[model samples]
Target: MSTATAEPAGRPEGAEDAQGAERAEGAEGTGPIRFGVVGTGWRSEFFARLARGLPDRLELAGVVTRSAERAARVRREWGVPAFLSVAELLAAEPEFVIPSVPWEVTPEVTGELVAAGVPVLAETPPAPDAAGLRALWEQVGASGLVQVAEQYPLMPGHAARIALVREGVIGTPTSVQVSSTHMYHAVSLIRHTLGVGFEPVTVTARAFTAPLADPLSPKGWSDDLTPKDARTTLALLDFGGGRSALYDFTDNQWWNPLRSRRMVIRGSLGEIVDETVVRMADPRTPYETPLVRRRTGLDLNLEGSEVRHITFDGRVVWRNDHTGAHFSEDDLAVVELLCRTGAWARGAAPEPYPLAQGCQDHLIALAVEESARTGEAVATGDEPWSA
Candidate 1:
């Protein structure tokens, strides 16, 4: 595994750095990397909130809203310039713009920015439907300036898993079972964990619905005994060479604690069940230890707390830019995405999540849904962007 760039610090993949690398963010640093957002919607708030939360590492250069009224509200809340169009947002000279609009309109917004030569860190599912996928790919696929924010694999826990898998600690990772996220995001983790690059695969899926108590959501818990039909999908992706993945997810799987968020990685020597790893310590020795997370500012501490890093057996596998800052794993992942994008735009790092990878993830995800709907195996066909 190569070192994937993280921010304020570069997070190289695989175990600890040979040089005993430590976080190098100065006790102080420059103003955060300046970037802009193109929408004022819910998804776009992550970008704005990240910049606002990490003042030392990011700066919200400007925002492109749909109307002057929304722009005014945004300006008051974020204390940053807000524009009604991309042209106006470009005037501030941001390093890039994230087209965080609806899936239906994302292509147009992204195409507009790409035409203007403004780099983009696009939102997920770059396009909504198959036609849109092909059209969007042909339009900006060759631009080399767009990187999608497929941040799941970069999430702290997943990053630790990948880093450990890369070191052969599990001995040739063979299979992955992901129930944490849906389709594309799940496929991303499966392919990454198996070390399979944009490879073709056969997918068989089935969908079943059952009457279950409606679980609580951010919107609020449902009234007790209110039964809602819940869809459960199970998908099998065979990548050949006996490398495969099983994706199990229920509707709103992300929010359903009753479903039990989990991952199982099987290897030649053993397997990993969530935080615990049962693998060979040596030829004759078997060892297991829970992945330990070191955090700061617990309980009665006034210094504030944040996830520091995850480790297995005392060896740090993944560390963040802000070691003690207030951030959840997902928050840290998104911050790293923005920072890495800024670095890529400035030629300080490689494209973080390339266009091809994002396209492939979505294409596979589509196959999952199709397979589930038709009650048959779906062969993942080559798309225009298949490399």
Candidate 2:
């Protein structure tokens, strides 16, 4: 994985250097990259909030909402021009546009934007189903203007682990177990940790259901504490050549307070379990260390409450560039995706997360679901984007 331009100090070894990278920021020397939003839903607001929070790096030029009332509310709340159509949003001349609409509508909107020759940072699972994914790929896969907003790899903990894996701290990752986010997001993490690309996978999965108390959601906590039956899906993805990933996910794990995210990346020399790493440092002895995070605003630190950097065995693996903004782990990941997308759009860096990669992630995720539903293994062969 190539590092983006304008990376902070303490980047891992073998990562790309920012010094020789081109500076093609549109009309502004190192100024914020201008972008537009094409929805008024919960996820779309993430982009708007990021633009407002990091004014020095991002600027929201306009937005496109479905209704006049929603457009008016967005304009009043976000203080950006809200339009009714993508064409009107394009008139703002944003360098790129983000489509955060529903699953079924995403590919259509993305195709429309691609037809206009505009760069797009689409939301996760660019299409709803396998057929939709195939159709969307046939339409826009050839166009290099589409990049998916797959930000899980950009999360601080995952970023740190990916760095260590790339630095050979774990020596050729063989398998990964992810009990974190669902579907494509987890697959993305698995691929990054294992360093596999476009490999065919055979997935075997099963789902179990149990009653659990779930009072939290995207809308916040509810008064009802009733226990509801929740489904947990477990999958084994065999990526061939002794590479595999274990995928585990529960319903509403993203916002449930009771469930915690966990990961284990196993390699020949060592393995990383959550934050702790156990590896052979020398032929005679084994070394165990924790990935420590430098978080400010603990007791007497005046630097505010935010993660500064992550260190493993006295070396910085990941450093936060937007430290003072006080973002959560997910927020940090999304912001990093936005920054990298900006660089890629301006030709300063490689495409952050291309369409094919996103397509593959979703294709595998869909296979996981199919295997779970059918109680049989599903083999995901090459698709149009596999090339």
Candidate 3:
């Protein structure tokens, strides 16, 4: 596409300035992790706004747009320096940079940033398709400086579920049913929940269509009763050794609120559905309990609330460091990813999500789509990054 200067006018109110955004929620005195963004698109705003709100943990060193006019707008609106190119942006000495460009051009932008020894945290898919993903990996996967911004596994509820799985709450998790996001994102969640790497897999899928009305959204929905064709695609991922996963997704499921998001993680001893769990509690007794969430700002509680943590019975499972950040689940998860990338870049944490894993997720997702379209089973384990 042409050099589209994605407007920051649509950015959420109060996220314009770090000091003024979320005073109640901004992280305090942990030292800011500096980074810049390489695009002015919707994805770029996420990082910029997050840094604006939580200056203690993140700093928006600068942002790069395609032209001087767009750069001027960025500077006037977000108060962070703006650059006409990646080279100009890096001159500000950001610890790392996040490439929030469109899918088709992400690899090019990423490669340019990498050549300057700038660490990168890339957006989803990393590249457009399997070939692009593989090519990108072959070029930078060995450098240990790039991390994909795949944060589904780190979402509070999802993270809690993963923690429970690792604790053997459901015994050995053999199957996972995820119907949240779509394509590579859903694949990433399934792989993380099932604790599988780039294993050989066989994928089979089918797409179904139906007319349905979407009722709600983050900004509420329309009262129009007109129906739209909702394509529901179901894919099965077989990870050998008695491990498999079912990925179910409906059209617009990512943003439509009428469709309730759900997951069913089944193991040998029991299973977890949403917030409740049914599993063996002891040698002779089977018990059932709910995953309770502690919130500070609802009901009769006058406190302006936020998610404090998630728990099973009384034990805390996932704690929310951004307790009052006023961020959504996805936003909260992304903030964690950014900080994790910062740590890895600074030699303080383990590799977050390697480029190969992101590629594998997309490669199998492509196979699922290919199989669904042709009504055949697609075999894996032949890719260069296959673990």
Candidate 4:
């Protein structure tokens, strides 16, 4: 294996200048944590963009893409070395490698990296299906070098809610209603807020078809002016012990403006619906408050329209650690995962998200799909990783 150092050749086009780069890189005084990526796909670019945004905390050491044309594009666009193999990428000595390839390819690449004794932060799902998940778990589940990049719980809004729930502000959470993202992402959020571990869940789901305007998607706004039939799947997850979750998802909900992202966490003493918190302060008194966000650059105060922190009951529940980075809420979560993975890889912090958690999340998600199709309830039993 090649052990040659792969360093940045020069600053890429549109990158910040020397003084600005230095200022951002030196902000934390520990230098940027260098990491490598093993794919150059669309999802991988999110990592590259976040590294550029949060220069003080992250640095892209190299990228591995099989296609020479894509590799050249990555080198030109990212201003980082592009290699053809994991061995070459590891030669750069990145603290960890993010396998952001396709779902089917993720487990194989992750196994390769783990076998090489390098820490890895794998993309979501980790495998394509249940069998794939089991096989992948059998391969690298006990390596203790794998962390999945599950960023949903790390988002500022969700993080704040989770903090409140953990602090007994909501008593013991009994159920959660998630209408935001879908599949494993939705499952991750539900499991996280309810604080449920590998407990077996009985999922009852069904699909409904309805007409809705399809204006927006991940690509962009569609010019076709027509209302199309959209699929909406709703499921009830029973975690036993009187804990449950209601999973609701509509097609294109992530980008469609008509369907807003929503969540509800119900506890013994109170419940949280989106940004509003309603709880019983005492035996007969009820309290209500909005989780206000300190966003800058609204009218005249020019801090540049970024989220500063989230507050509840006059106390800060979630603070933007990358305040000056000008990142969106989703970007904030991704960048936080990258930094936390880097810290764990270097033994400076605990594992951010373990592979077993991802496996369980996906397993439950698959059951959701199955129950929706078969029109019957599905139960997920213990898996190898569930232990």
Off by over 4 Å in 3: 1-30, 215-220, 282-284, 300-302
| Candidate 2, residue 376: lDDT | 100
lDDT against the true structure, each candidate: 0.78, 0.85, 0.78, 0.84
Question: Top TM-score: which candidate number?
Answer: 2
Order of quality (TM-score): 2, 4, 1, 3
Candidate 4 global lDDT:
0.84
My TM-score estimates for the predictions, one after another, are 0.90, 0.93, 0.89, 0.92
Candidate 4: list runs displaced more than 4 Å: 1-29
| Evaluation by TM-score, superior candidate among 1 and 4 | 4
lDDT at residue 371 of model 2 (Cα atoms): 99
**Candidate 1 lDDT, 106-215, residue by residue in tens:** 88988998898777888888888778888999999877767788888888778878777877778889999998999778988887788776667899999999976656
For residues 1-387, what per-residue lDDT tens digits would candidate 2 score against the true structure? Answer: 123322222222332223213324342436788989888888878788988888999999999987999889998988889999999999998888999999999999999998988888999899999999999999988777888999888888888888888788888899999998999999988887887777789999999999888889988899777989999999999999999999999999988988998999999899999999998867988989999999998999998888888888898778888877898878998888888878777767666788888888899999999999999999988788776
- Candidate 3 vs candidate 4: the TM-score winner is 4
On residues 56-124, what C-alpha lDDT tens digit does candidate 3 reach at each position?
A: 788999999988898888888888899987888888988778888889988998888877777788887
> After superposing candidate 2, which stretches have Cα over 4 Å from the reference?
1-29
lDDT of 4 at 301: 90
Clashing pairs in 3: 18-52, 296-305, 297-305
